[model samples]
Target: MTDRPDPFAAPFGSLFGDSMTQAELVDGTYSYSGSAQPMENFSLHPATHVLHYGSACFEGLKAHRQSNGTLALFRLDDHVERMRQSIGLLRMPVPDAALIRSLIIDAVEANADFTPDPPGSLYVRPTFIGTAPNIGAAAVPSDMGLLYVICSPVGDYFAGGIRPLTIYVETKVPRTTPQFGMVKSGANYVMALGPTLDAKRDHGADQVLFATADDITETGASNFFLIDDDRIITRQLDESFLHGVTRDSVITIAGDLGYSVEERPLSPSELADWAETGEVFLSGTAAVVAPVGTVIVEDSARTVRDGEPGPNTLRVRDALTTLLTGDADDPHGWRTTVSG
Candidate 1:
């Protein structure tokens, strides 16, 4: 870690590892060297398909430095499957799951020396982009693509660590188009930029919680949650929002820890009511489990009960952290060990 800026001092995802693995898709076949090489930039044509047609998608996961001095990737297979789904959705040449998994592992192993301590980890990003130099093919899928994996040593996704966040609720604007919400594509994120920026500028919000037509879906980059002493509730899975891996992990862990899990439609009215009596949180790969302190609804600010991190939120977060760091038993078999 010498001769490098501290990850905690720099912004998350700003620092990169020394190596990367890349594979190219031509016609319908894929080719790779089966190992990581020196990290560098790619030279793409000005009229690349992805530049104009938005044929790009990405996945975010992490590799943790365990207590026993080894690195492990959490929910590696699930991330791989989701990335494949995203690529297929973009109408690009989807790579095999095994190839994606091997590339990720090899990249992680090549950068294993950069993995930070417990509070920090190596953020792994697998990206795919259409490479055909065709700006006219707006209605057609590109036949050539590039798939690559990179790693970044990150401290925390949020600026401050483990504190409650303030979110603004936008009932009129959605995070993204309903039909394409489930895909992990860059277009989906760009669509939410306006609302998120407006919320942050006008309402002093950390993020925007999008709930079009009074139906709550998710924040810009994470899933919403409502928790109490006996039950954990979130929105039902659909094509309207992302199905998060961290969200699934939280539900499963909570159910095993004796809380009733409910997946159904949630609304802002119900959330306001729950804020008076329950706890609210958000979950994602970047934000493992983030407590919601205040929600600005229709220009009216409402504080969650006591406006602080609740016990149940911390309990689940601690459990997830322990599992990620190999401090607890892997009963779910979700961790993948990456070795050189």
Candidate 2:
């Protein structure tokens, strides 16, 4: 039997699996060296471009251990494509998609025994950082880059499991730039951290709903969705928030379940008005589908359906969980089984 780390005792983002995949971008070419020995620290100069200018991009996805004892990756190809797009948008050298995919599969397979069962997954983080050391200047198209994939066995992201989360809506601060919002880069989250922390500290909220100039964008790390009795409404995908893969999956599954999914601009006023009748939730790879109990907007806290996880939210989450674990027929073909 393979020795696995005690996930329950491991600190967040600290305990990684036995090995990781490393690749280097040199002279505009990517050289993948397959899986490598686990290293706790990275060697980079003090003037690394990523440290100063934030030329970094990343992708987050999971490999789940199904009931049938098979390990499957949730939408691996889509994540790879998204990572490629993020690199392109950041003007960083892009890694080969096929190579990256292979690296991910290999890393997961290498650490397959470490993946926890249901309610836990192998959290895969594929990161690209600009390694060029030039403090006075920004990397001109990011000449040097490092691409590495790390896996961690994580349980539920939310401490209380699938309970409804309280979110605070920020009408002043924007989540990210219009053009770069869709990209998975560290800068975007950094921009949102202050507001989120304030929300948690001041309002006792779980997350922040980042509204750009009064227009609702997204929650801190996930896409926001509102479910009415008849239809589902979410903010339209633009340049400000991430196009979450889990959001896409939820929308598709909701559509298949006969719910009309509407993508449009959602204002804070509209959200306040809609909160009376609609159910709100945040969707992401980490949180999956986390229902919103209340949204603290400014001084007033608006409750969504008595501040509880609504029936619709629970139903969708159940459906998604079933689909993800291979209990349901996967029509979208998102699952990729991994071999140990």
Candidate 3:
């Protein structure tokens, strides 16, 4: 067999693994029976419901290869549960929670040899979409649906190592609708793409801090957090943004390290006040815990504490990494070992 190209060196989504797991829904029931076939183009009709009505959702999580040569998925159950919730909200027929988890684990194990070590991981993407070609009226629930999980070995998101990022605090444009914000649906991210692109172009920012009319929501794809000398504060969970699994992991780890944790509504005006005395960071699956060095509010800017990755941010990130790699005791039982 020919050697597979290094997915880590390829651009995002361009290089997929050799195989994938697929399932289909027909007449309101799911039938899963497929192997990891070669990655290739998908066949879909021109008027597919997903193309016209945007009936699709997806989840992102990683599988880490531990130092002991064993692979474990971080918060796999949480991700499966969130995907189920998204399917329900989107009115798409999907498999049970157990089936979804099995699909994800099986796909990861099938591509075990591609799971990179340490800072690199096998990124798993599970997507669901309506395939029926009736675009005139999509109010009727889709009779057909497709579910699949694709794996890719991804390197560090920032090639230059961990550094503070500059973010634009946007108040006028909302990230997404309040009802759909919590769901891991494609439409949610689609809504923020335009504004985020504008922020990057006009303000030279890395991400957009989407805020509600009165409260701050989240960045483009990650949740936001503030780290002070003794406390960690973030926006309380509501219908305005995604409740990230990584965010929960960070909060739990921080609390264990003797830092006070508070979840409340954060406003744009409070950025200067918080920056005066604390450090800020973004938390998510891809980012883990990315420090925020600067926050640009309209034309004015405020530098985070010391304008660098705060000691507390680094501490929490290290703690989480240790737990994920099996160096530290996983008190939360978040990791699931995948059989090769």
Candidate 4:
């Protein structure tokens, strides 16, 4: 542990744990070792299905080293269910929920020595890829696949800790295909790369908010939100974007704090109007709750209410943090403790 680089100082997701768990699917059946194994590179054929056909997806969640000297996985079951949904959508045979849960637990517990302190956590990545070695089967789902869970000791997804972000509104380019938007696939991420890089180079933005003809969807990697003194508003769930776990947690905690949660269609005009008074933020597994201070719509850049982290935003953030670190009671049963 002393020889490893500090996760806080290093780039996020660069420092990995020593152990991992994996399973293989062949001929419509799955096989796992029922234990953790040493982390290593995988050998794949040049014509692997995922390489040419894009038959891959993944889920991101965290295992926090709690205030009480224990480690717990946040929203573990929900992530498992979402990963299964993603696999099913990829036209592959989905692994049972129990198998996925056990794999995560085994991987986390095996790497418990690598767990960092609060404000830093063990970022767990459960990935699935097709390995059928068939470049000709673009329309056919792979009969062979690999499912694995690995851990990375991470600090912050965005650098400089938690601060307000600058978002660029993209009204012309859609993030991904509408029907497949809900899947957590790398293809969806690659679709946003061109616009995101352009925004960074031209507008100096932190992330690109895809509106696609004034219909607000989400940022590249997180869910969007509009927060104020009384209510919280966001785009209702459909097939247009990823439904975030932290987004759900925020809505639940905000409701517990008496803020009205409204899930509906949000437009760029409505966002510009809300930025005049209300607060805005992004939520995700990697980014717990990120405050937005500025938004660039076309040629105009609008600041969100003095361009600082608002009180309500901080309040919700604090509550979620407390619950995550085990300082508060688990009323919703969101945390699952893993054995050290």
> lDDT per prediction?
0.93, 0.85, 0.85, 0.94
Taking the tens digit of each residue's C-alpha lDDT, what string does model 2 give over 1-340? Answer: 1466666556545567878887888898988876655645787899898989899899999998887889999999999999999999998766778988987898888877778777788899988998888887663755788888889888788876888788888888787777888889898888888888888899998898888678888887898998976789888887667889999999999999999999988888888887898899999999999999888776699998788899999899999998878888889999999896
Q: What C-alpha lDDT does candidate 4 achieve relative to the native structure?
A: 0.94
How well does each candidate superpose onto the true structure, as a TM-score?
0.99, 0.95, 0.96, 0.99
- Roughly what TM-score does model 1 have, to 2 decimal places? 0.99
Could you tell me the TM-score of candidate 4? 0.99
Clashing pairs in 1: none
Which segments of model 1 are wrong by more than 4 Å? none
Tens-digit per-residue lDDT, 149-220, candidate 4: 999999999999988999999999999999889999999999999999999999989999999978998999
lDDT (0-100) at residue 275 of candidate 2? Answer: 84
**In model 3, where do residues sit more than 4 Å from their true spots?**
1-8
Judged by whole-model lDDT over C-alpha atoms, candidate 3 comes out at 0.85
In candidate 4 the C-alpha lDDT for residue 259 amounts to 97
TM-score pick, better of 2 and 3: 3
TM-score of 3: 0.96
Number of colliding residue pairs in model 2: 1
Cα lDDT of model 1 by residue, 19-62, tens digit = 99999999788888999999998899999999999999999999
